[model samples]
Target: MFEVNRVTARSSSLDAAHWQRRLDVLAENHGVAGAVLGILHGDDMMSAAFGVTNMRTGAPVQTDTVFQIGSITKVYSATAALRLVADGVLDLDKPISTWLPTLRLADDAAHRVTLRHLLTHTSGIAGDVFTDTGRGDDCLERYVDGLASVPQLLPPGTGFSYCNSGFSLVGRVIEQVTGKVWDRAMHDLLFAPLGLDTTMTLPEEALLHSAAMGHEHQADGTLQPAARWGLPRSNGPAGGIVCTARDVLAFSRFHLNDGRVPDGNTLLPRALVRDMRSTQIELPFYDGDNNALGLAWFRQTWDGQSLIGHDGYTVGQNAFLRLLPSHQLAVVLLANGGPAPDLYRALYSEIFAELAGVAMPSPLHPPQGSSGFDTGHHVGTYLGYNHEHEVLDDDGVPSLRWAATGSLVDVMPTTEGEYEAIAAGGDLLLYREPGQRRWRPATFVQLPDGRSGLYIGLRAYIRAS
Candidate 1:
């Protein structure tokens, strides 16, 4: 980790070599099949690709190797919608039902759900609704239609829940306005204008490039080609974009340019671009202090400096993007297989510390200096979309137990009213913030109608007890 004060100028020669060595060591350490890491400091950008695209095929990972970026597509989807808003074709504050007429949520709050809610993830729709709506261009349309039967987890604009279905609905609105599919709309409005030729939304287009295959980690400690290569067509608007680390850096640079294309052409209103980085809601339980949600970006701070970024995971592939606007810096990492997250935490922490003079906050873990707080109130089964968490007190040891995944995580008190979930492998997985975060825990408050829930990572998990 290089300190900002310790370094003066951008030297691609020295920085590139240093980062390449770091990437190589990490790849070997984690057994990653292939990986790409990119960094942008002011006007200078450097990237290194290492390992094979697939262990089975032994295809080398080149600079242009395309990998599924997952939910980073939400930022592009949000940008497309902002374009429509810029042209007076759509309104940010207007209810989405006005544009996506077919969208009917189980809750009456559907009438109040606006484009802003969808963009900011405050629409209260369920997350992980990865239903396959077919490969036709009408996939987003059908996906929105199917959402009618989906139950609302909270009132629109009243809470935060990362909703892929909401972005799918936003895609439907883009289709209704442009009379084209979401992918086409994205190309016309953002990709083409930004000269992002290496980026694509479908498998066919991605296949034309040297693309990386997803790999799954096996119980025997080896990687095998994943069963599914691409997400369903319905997920395009949510997390279906495929691109290289270089192209992803270009996308990051475009946003840093205040919504301008490479040729200095204005693609979106600068104000809207600024608004995308502004706070929409507080997410204290997230990564760092003052963590919040922007229009589509996740905002947080490190060393009292603001940062923005998003992460994506599509089955076996994981990607991460982080931006420090104050320093005009961006770092992106794309990887395939199980050890991605571990590598990401280590690599990002080192890069950001050296390049930006900001310490990448360590993953949440119990403070060893202090004894754990009482875990009595937090003990219960909390349920969310297809996932359940049970906080238990087994023989005086507090732990978080997963229902479906069968993973038991020891809970060590990090501070008063907060606990860190220590994974069985001794890694810090997450922090359970009760009274300290903006949103309350399942036991924090009882709803007006006598219902209660736990707020973790912007999702409200109903207390299933």
Candidate 2:
């Protein structure tokens, strides 16, 4: 069990030795190739890096090492859009068509999409159908232009679905209003003003010297370097920015400090920043714990305290950032190897539990004398409230699989009754029902009370003959 280390309310720093030990253990035990972490409290901060930036060359990671920040880029993009709102060039309630005439969804109702809808991911726009080749700027625009081919899954502001398409549209809005490309606008509005020198939309010739080569675990349980590619110019607004731990920490702190620069320059109005952090949509697609959407950030409650941030995954990189508004605490974690499918969320939750003086939940463990049953029982066809599962044989051994969602998970029993579903592609959770005839599948569900709950919260499943 993870224990919470008592910290004083006035304490500005965590135990450096404790953080170092946790970082080392995460790297060694979690198959993480490289990790960059930053912790902020009040006016003081601590940042550290562990593991190799490049596994093949065995080069050590430095505090300044840059990693692709994945969807965390959305926060910056959303901030840029809100800044325009502050400047009176954009309106939160006005339709996006006010800025870009070409932007449209299948339904004519989609024309009602406002900057608020785009920022909170309620535009009802579908995400990109093609992978971001990271090749050029036209990629995202072409993707947006092709949206007429796909159907709208939900109506605008009716329900919450994480639409990457909404953010890409935000990028286009930036272009239309500022007369500058999304990348350049971001550089001017956010990065340059804050001195985040390591943040960039594309890998520059200079970054080649220190760029950490991303990697993935191979079939034989060996680490292999993954190829690096440029994110298309179009998708730059959604998930294209790359930066070091220190820079990300600075960005996160800006939100924690109410959208001001380190020296107290008011880059964003406090009211607007508060609006960005306020819950605009109750995201139904994500695990309904405290997961919510506020402007562009995922808002949640941890140990009774509110945290605002987002997690990102692309190519072979995974990143996470969390900011506690009440305490002015921020944490940023970046990893090269994608392990623990839920690595980012779990790490942040554990860290926050410790920081907030709560005991961390026990890790899940597989049933004893049932090693063979672990994969076999969870392998067959199973249906749940929001998703379906079809376990299949990968190499003669059963593995839990989801086709419609494109998730492939390997189950590992931790210690308690919980089982950890590790997907190289991502992470999720599985819990056995205590009294059912077989294992019950857990998925996202919307409660009738207008609240959200997980399947595990309803009842426990137990195996019966």
Candidate 3:
């Protein structure tokens, strides 16, 4: 159990000393270069920073230091789209082609996708198309124009897939309706109105802050700066927003407070806010009590309580946000590579347990006393974005062989059809159904158009015939 010590200047309910000590221990153990953690309980907010902002410069991370928030940008984009819905500028149920007719997909069914499908990630379009459409203002325009070459993974509205390109299209919709560039509209609609000082989309805007550079951990245990600062500007709406942990907590508070901004102005209607956080689609084969997709938010049930949150990754940085509406609490974690996953798991578990009375769900292990099951039915090749999965029978035991962009992982099964991905350092990455009751392994999904594909990581990979 975590104990509260003397109150700090920033929080009334938490012991800053206690969290600082734990963070220190976790960062040291994980070789983390830099991190920021922030928490909000009602009107009270507390935050702590650990490690260095840059490995070479050794600059200490300040509480307000900014890091790339990545796909959390999707939530901002989704909020912007819903605002358009409220203003009668756009209809959620209307076909996206009604607004951007120039956009094209390889499948006719996919071409009929609606705004709702894009927001919920059911558009079925190949989601990982991160081509650099240049830094010009017309970048997203070119991005959508180039979609003629992108294939449809499934017919639109059939299944959920994590679609980065879909969010980029949403950004284009914002541009079409608002007559402002996506990032400019984002600032005017979200950042400026929400009083978020550091949240921004461009490298030039980010240069104004004491920004943290991403650090990649090498095989020899050395850390180096990332070769690229970020993806192209056109990827902004998908996964390109940069902000501090404190600002992320503020954004979480806005959602918790029924869409009201800091100045008591309603940025969006209360009902739309509720709908955004409500379950929009059911995730297949998820292990949690009730895991589903809620607009841009991912929903999970823990200890009979509902948790809504989103996580983002960009280059060498990872960001996590978790909100407990019932408790009126939210937590944000930002890290620049080097064992970030391990630290986040440990820190969030302790914080949520102590503050919200919700236990961090246990890591998934193979079912107790497994009976031998037929492996023949599950053997085949599964595909993902720029990757392939090959299931093989290794001496009567099932195994998963994955190859992706010059990387490979071959692991024997710990149970039927699921394998324990062991890292070189002997870490167990259990990639089975609902590992941690949050994410599930890939499974076969059939489209309404009579096509089949593997649905994993919230995106479909059309199986090669």
Tens-digit per-residue lDDT, 92-117, candidate 1: 89887787666677776567999999
Candidate lDDT values, in order: 0.75, 0.64, 0.76
The candidate maximizing lDDT is: 3
Query: What C-alpha lDDT does candidate 3 achieve relative to the native structure?
Result: 0.76
| Top-down lDDT ranking | 3, 1, 2
* Residue 3 accuracy (lDDT) in model 3: 20
Error of 2 at 451 (Å): 19
Give the best candidate by TM-score: 3
Tens digits of per-residue lDDT for model 3 on 7-125? 23365566776777787778777778888888888888888778777777777777778999988889989998898899999998888888887667777643489999998988888
Clash list (residue pairs), candidate 1: 2-354, 442-453, 442-454
**lDDT per residue, candidate 2, 134-189, as tens digits?**
45656556766766655554467665556666788788788888988788889899
The whole-model C-alpha lDDT of candidate 2 against the native structure comes to 0.64
Candidate 2, poorest ten consecutive residues by summed lDDT: 406-415
lDDT of 3 at 403: 55
